[model samples]
Target: MSKLFRAVIMGPPGSGKGTISERIAQSFGLKHLSSGDFVRENIAAKTEAGVQAKTYIKKGLLVPDLVMTRLLLPRLEEMTKYSWLLDGFPRTLAQAEALNSACDLDVAINLNIPLETLKERLRHRWIHPPSGRVYNMCFNPPRIQGIDDITGEPLIQQEDDRPEALVARLRHYKDVAKPVIDFYKAKGILYTFSDTETDQIWPNISTLLSTKIPTIQSDARCASTH
Candidate 1:
């Protein structure tokens, strides 16, 4: 069997982690496991950890590290047969440590976009609330400015996406992420990509993964023959 690859992508909001993660998953045939989506799925299913998580969430409290690890680690254990890319978990040093105890990570991809760049990107972002469709005025603008393409409803900029709020959020992310980055760096698995645009950074990530990921197709063929 080909060696299983495990990776996590980290970035502040507007740093293009989602787009980059999507590309990595598609290009490498790794399952993309989003922590946010997983939490939501568990909550919808009302699993034990999910039920615990809901109480904190209902109180507008961040779920404790223990609950997060309990919710995440089991799902990861189930994917032993497949390479995977994880996103949006381990927002703090404590969570990172919990994850470290659970499994060894092969890579920690960090996006270090400039504050100004992030601000510009986020400032232009708008969303259609009803359908949860997002549009970037700079790139993927709707057919009509300030209007949802499908419903023609007016789009709204999230309060958190505003410049002042974004600055505070981004600062908080940097403060929270530094220790995690250092932890991965010390482990020699952290790869940081810095650029103003996702397009510019993607080629470098693709090259890195090409060298890192083993050829799974041949392994699959060999298994089939046996």
Candidate 2:
């Protein structure tokens, strides 16, 4: 049987994990799964897990570990036949341990972006809600200010990306993610990239994965046009 490469990406908001993940998925053949997407899907489908999560969300409470694990694990099981890249799943130490027990991870990529850079990037970030298309003022601005490029709908910044909420989110992410990073480090498969732009970090990440997995070529580049 062919080997399966399971990878998890860890980064704070506005760290370009999504862009890098898409490049990796396109360059290689790994299935890409985003935890946020999973929750959104379940909630839209009104599944049991979604209903339970919605109850907690409506009450202004975080979803329990049990519910998160129950909701995410089945999705992984369905992808047992393919190598996959996961984003935003194991946010806490408990989630990391749970994931460890479920499957072996080949590598865990940590993006160590500067706080100021993250703040600047996210502050300028706006999205098209219906399609989840993100546009950054500094990097890729839309044709019109505060407008979606594709649909021409008004774009709005996410509440969490706003200055007031960004500080708290970054603090919480650092606190919860340290142990998870340490865990992967101990396992000897932790590869970290520190940069201000996704383009700067993509080459190193591409090189690392290419070295670790024989499915890709070392000379491959994630094009800016993507």
Candidate 3:
């Protein structure tokens, strides 16, 4: 069997982490595990940790780090047999430490988009909340302006996406993410890609993974055969 590869992608909102993560999962044949989706699933299923998390979420409070670790670590344990890419967990230094204690990470991909570019992209963004479909006016606009393509429903911009709110959010993200980035950097597994567009960054990430994945997998395969 090939060696299992584990990675995490980190970026502020509007940095295209979702799109990049999806592409990485598709290109590398790694399972994409989204922390947000997993939390929602557990909440829907009424798991103990999820029930505890939902209480904090309902009170407009961030879930405690212990709850988050409890919710996330077991999910990682289950993915032991396959390579996987984790997205949207470990938003703080405490959580990062919890994750460090749980498993060794092979890579930590960081997106370093310019502030102006992130603002521009987010300002033109709209969403169909019911279906969770996102549309960007500058690039991937709907067929009719301000309308959902399939449902023709009027789209709404999230208040959090507004420039005023975005600045504060980005500031918070930078503060929270710095320690985690430093932690990974110290481990020599952090790769940061800076660009105005996701397309420009994709090729570089693809090249890095192509080199890293095959070499490790081949070595593991050779050892297994012996």
What RMSD, rounded to one decimal, does every model reach?
3.9, 6.2, 2.6
- Which lDDT tens digits does candidate 3 get at residues 82-181? 8988888788889999988988888899999999999999999898765556789987899999999999999999878899988988998999999999
- In the range 1-226, model 2's lDDT, one tens digit per residue, is 3467899999998898777888899987788898777876788899999988888866534577788899999999999988999988798889999999999998999999999999999999998866667789988899999989888889998767887778888888899899999999999989999989898999899888887777422222333224
lDDT over C-alpha atoms for residue 32 of model 1: 86
Where does model 2 exceed 4 Å of error? 55-62, 142-154, 215-226
**Candidate 3 positional error at 102, Å:** 2.0
List per-prediction Cα lDDT, in the order shown: 0.86, 0.86, 0.88
Candidate 1 residue 48 Cα shift, in angstroms, is 4.7
Q: Candidate 1's residue-wise lDDT over 65-170, tens digit each?
A: 8899999999988998888899888888999998888788888999999999989988998987655566889868999999999998999987777888888888
Clashes of each: 0, 0, 0
Report the Cα lDDT for residue 122, model 3.
Answer: 95
